[model samples]
Target: MAGNKQPVSVLVLLYTAQGRVLLIERADKPGFWQSVTGSKEGQEALLATAWRELGEETGFAAAQGVLHDWAQSSVYEIYPHWRHRYPEGVTHNTEHVFAFELSEESTPRLNAREHTAYVWLDWQEAAQRVFSPSNAVAIRELGRRLSPLS
Candidate 1:
């Protein structure tokens, strides 16, 4: 799938009721921690893309947890370093946000090809640790979601 990623993608944030967010360190770009993320396939539903990416990147099957589509999306300029993954002239992408809530933080079967390390941190700290702006935004939003009254 080299240089063929769709401009539309999914960002699945796996968290617990306690607000601990799961973050994975990218293998190709170590120290870049993020939630499960990937591009959509042709004509695929955004929900399906989220589920697929969840399993592929973190080994969490759809049946293992319930996915919540926050119905949130953000369009941003793609990072120059990874822009080659998309077609020529494609400089931006729309990322749809989804979330999977677990009762507790569980060990995920991390895909070594994509990630080298994993950590579960409080939403605030996770938000600060993510490298991508959009990813950080999503994580920060997680706090609001878990505590809409706070």
Candidate 2:
């Protein structure tokens, strides 16, 4: 699989039922906050990617609560520094969106190699705080989905 394209990844917007979103600062880029995100390993399914990344990056297990597949995907340019992880000609990635709602607020044990810190913010503030356009789009979608009916 060395030269094969990296499978699509998942971006899980971890939030509370009350609409607070979780944002984790990237260890590689301090002050850059985002939700759980990672590529699939081998032939693993995309949902599996979401579950695995959640556990690996934040110590959260999907079975313990709600994890919904938003059935949304976005393609965006792969940041230059991380492009080497994908195939030579691949310059973009398709990220599937998911949501994890915890029963209540909880502290995440971040993977120090991947993230520097974590915060819970109101959805609007979370959307503004995310660094990636695709990530921000996903946050907006989450807001729309969770908003109460008029």
- TM-score against truth, every candidate: 0.96, 0.93
Candidate 1 clashing pairs? Answer: none
Q: Which lDDT tens digits does candidate 1 get at residues 42-61?
A: 99999999988898988887
Q: What is the lDDT of residue 17 in candidate 2?
A: 77
How would you encode candidate 2's per-residue C-alpha lDDT over 1-150 as one tens digit per residue? 224658488999999878899999999998888999998789899988898999999998865679999898988998887776788778888899999999787899899999999999988999999999898998887888888772
Residue 125 lDDT, candidate 1, scale 0-100: 98
Best by TM-score: 1
Q: Residue 67 of model 2: what lDDT?
A: 94
Clashing pairs in 2: none
Model 1 TM-score, all chains together: 0.96
**How much lDDT does each candidate structure score?**
0.93, 0.88
How many Å off is the CA of 71 in candidate 2?
1.0
